[model samples]
Target: MSVRESTFPGVGALRQTGRLFALAASVVRLTFKRPFQKREFVEQFWFIASVTILPTALVSIPFGAVIALQVGSLTKQLGAQSFTGGASVLAVIQQASPLIVALLISGAGGSAICADIGSRTIREEMDAMEVMGVSPVQRLIVPRVLAAMLVAVLLNGLVSVVGVLGGYFFNVIMQGGTPGAYLASFSALAQLPDLYISELKALIFGFIAGVVAAYRGLNPGKGPKGVGDAVNQSVVITFLLLFFVNLVLTAIYLQIVPAKGS
Candidate 1:
């Protein structure tokens, strides 16, 4: 491919990303305006949570189990088996919770949002609302964004709890780890700030996923294929942004939150 052809997609992606950010900012501004859609927000909250919670629980268990197995094996080899709980718990809270929550938000909630809005767009329902002076961003997008944030934070906590439990069970039962040591050292290496940072990460990821899905849905091209493409792109874009944002947040947290007992 020629240089121009290869670079075109990159340029287009940057432009689309800019538009996504602008749409997110618009939703945020609309959120503070009058006539808050409290009903819609509540409905969306329930919907997103219903779809996300079970999947998150299923994923969190295996996630913690695998981590515990790996950490336990290495710690045993080094005669530091007692630290397995602390290590596994910290890993779940600091890394797994946010990441898993983000993935579910993007995959489950984001796709649903994209498909819902995309259908509205394709049917010109959004345009009809616009003609009636109903701001779609305020009436629809803002509530979904807020719902995603709320569900994400709650899901992160759920994931953390389940992950810790899974780790405990695996380490103590399957791996022959001491139950007392696991429980005693569970929080030994974790600081309060770690929990705060993990929640913050989940909040940010949810907001990003919601906004991107809304943007893609709102701006879909003509035809059913366009809606499908928008949904696909929404998931892909959310995943990309989620990982990048997680990396940046992790770095910032490390700088701001000192290690436990430090």
Candidate 2:
């Protein structure tokens, strides 16, 4: 374990993890305090969505096609070709879609947020707010974090739809699979919880991205270069946290939710 004399003396990752959760809680608490920053939230939502949506859709198509192709090949080999659509689409919806959203949001939206806030922090705007009896977390960080969560949920649904379509197209056209069987299999195998978990993952990931970015922004190093470094660190840290959280959530979900026909 690494040690940082700044925050936690004995450990590095654990201390940062605690700090990140603390920041998240602050953001959540500020979310309920009014008058809410509707305009800031709207602006941030539009900005994040504008930057992430197109790239997400583009990435999802190829992502879905690849999963469909692989699953199709496997099922065909096992003489379970009729289950290809269900297996492939479910994989895309339940796993790949949220991961894609997390990646884009962290890489694009989260990085932008980190850079913007880090710049403001280094410029002493955060301190000025403190001196003026203003809460920077309430005024700035809260809206951005909330916006990321909302956008992520919406984008998760969009990615699931587009990804399922892409997967279907590939399975049916490229793999010479039957469209009817594909639809039927998916209908038979997919449950409402599959979608619920996917959107939940996106929401959680979005929150993680925003909180990590904001936290790093709040504590950047001593200069302009530090802001850039903070942005990179925020993205990397968010990615690692998202993946770990995803694994844990997926395990819990599988244990709690029974499979179809099981």
lDDT of 2 by residue, 1-262 (tens): 1111222223577777777777888888879998899999999999999999999999999999999999999999999999998998889988999999988998999999989988898888887888898888889999999999999999999999999999999999999999999999999899999999999999999999999888888877778778888888999888899889999999999999999878
Q: Which stretches of candidate 2 lie over 4 Å from their true place?
A: 1-11
- Model 1: residue 197 alpha-carbon error in angstroms: 0.8
Candidate 1 weakest ten by summed lDDT: 1-10
Model 2 worst lDDT run, 10 consecutive residues: 1-10
What's the lDDT for all of these models?
0.88, 0.89
Top candidate when judged by TM-score against the true structure = 2
Clashing pairs in 1: none
TM-score (all chains, Cα) for each model: 0.93, 0.95
User: With candidate 2 superimposed using the best TM-score fit, by how many Å does residue 103's alpha carbon deviate from the native?
Assistant: 0.9
lDDT, candidate 1, 61-143, per-residue tens:
99999999999999999999999999999999999999999899889999999999988888888878878988888899999
